[model samples]
Target: MDEVLARQAFDTALDEHRPEFGTFFLARLLGLKISYPDETCVIEFPVRDFLFNPQGSLHGGVIATVMDISMGHLLRHAYGGAGATLEMKLQYLSALKTGSATCIAKFLRRGRSIAFLESRLNDANGNLSAVATSTWKCSPSADPTDGKRVP
Candidate 1:
């Protein structure tokens, strides 16, 4: 592992940490760059050695987290509120060992009290590495004072 790079990542996350939107700590730690285009949410991050598993590939948990973030952020961007993930299912198709990965999310369905979303993770070369679908319990909005979901 590149200790200097890892330390720099940690410092950046600590410095840029925020309680709202895309500036959450984990997102910062992973150096996630989030964007919304039309009706979809996209997140891109580097595949670093510090994020790797013993097998020298990005960890499955990290992949799942990125997918989850994409879907959750999509809900927040489309609607006027954030949502709690009630459940999520993921499938890993390819191993990512280098370059960057991008996750794109879109809503499958949206309702007053429930939402369904899907996210696809692709490697730098545009290979589909993983996919995730999730269900969320909707919230009315976020409390600006504390960044908590308001119902």
Candidate 2:
């Protein structure tokens, strides 16, 4: 592993993490660049060796986390509230060894209190790597602008 890059990633996460938008710790650690293009939430990130599994591929858990964040960010952006993931399922279609990957999350259905969302992760070459579908419980009382969890 590249110790310098790993340390930089850790330092960046510590220095830049916030509760709002795309500034979360995990996002920083993964060097994720998040954006809203049209109605979808997109996250592009580098594939670091530190995040690789024993077999030398990007770890499945890391992929799943990015997929989850994409959906959650979409919920927060579109609804002005945060969401609690009730359940999520993922399918890994391929392994990513190098280059960056982009995960795009979109809503399948949005309701008053519940939502269905899906995220697709593709390699930099535009090959599909994984897909995730999830159900979320919207916290209607949370305010998106303030980035505070309502409880």
Candidate 3:
């Protein structure tokens, strides 16, 4: 699809699904399906031409964005608020040629003002393709530390 149509579709979805869109409009554009269960956040999406590099592989930025979103999603679920990425490191083990893939994020630690999370991205065949670790500082708007003491 062209950029105009893509933007229009994104606008339509945003209008229909307001206030609870996961991550951002790009995820919606990229067709990311997000799920939460127990202590993990999972996102599955297809690798499309728009998200590919010149070499015909999934872009590194796309992988990083999914990883980052997974971590942020986990922090929001566990802490009741989204977070800002203070830092993150990613390792791209292999290239994804095509098809859908999955990203699973789990919390390493949830602190008063910061959270640590890790995400693993698996290819369409369910083989590990990339991994990332990130630290996020709880945003003021979503901070769970408003005079509430941690147990």
Candidate 4:
């Protein structure tokens, strides 16, 4: 992939395709910060008290959200289209607590109508706490302005 093209795609994803993302309730809840100009999309969030479970560990749902966003954003930025999750599977290997967490997402393959993606969440200590794999159904036709995300 060309650097210029990747940068342009990243800008489009952040600025043009889903401008409403800034106001998305979940986004604000997680305080997601995005960084991607390459094949992988990286999302980070500071673990807040409200996100903790009774065990004082990060909730699985929150971790899953990060994984989903990471892969979804990767699909959008890499292919210039939005994708819907058809199926998802997650595996939790450890509990995450303290500091921050980051999710690294990448596409394994993209076919005509389906895409396979995976993500890994690393705790503040850089230990892998969870992993997720998903299949997204890509649209056959996309809006010229917003790509494949259907409203």
Best-performing candidate as measured by lDDT: 2
lDDT of 4 by residue, 27-129 (tens): 6556678888567888888876567788888888888888988888887776567779999999999998778988999877767677889999998889999
Off by over 4 Å in 2: 142-151
lDDT of each: 0.89, 0.91, 0.82, 0.76
TM per candidate: 0.91, 0.91, 0.82, 0.77
Least accurate stretch of 10 residues (summed lDDT) in model 1?
142-151
lDDT of 3 by residue, 3-78 (tens): 6755765785576553564846667767788999878999998877666788888999989988998898888887
| lDDT at residue 45 of model 4 (Cα atoms) | 80
Give the per-residue lDDT of model 1 (tens digit) for 11-86: 9999999999899899999999999997899999999999999999999999999999999898888767878999
Q: Any residue pairs clashing in model 2, and if so which? A: none
Model 3 pairs in collision = none
Where in model 4 is the C-alpha error above 4 Å? Answer: 1-19, 142-151
Candidates 1 and 4 compared: the better one by lDDT is 1
When summed lDDT is taken over every stretch of 10 residues in candidate 3, the lowest stretch is 142-151
Cα RMSD to the true fold for all candidates: 5.4, 5.2, 3.7, 10.9
Off by over 4 Å in 3: 1-19, 140-151
- Per candidate, the number of residue pairs that clash is 0, 0, 0, 0
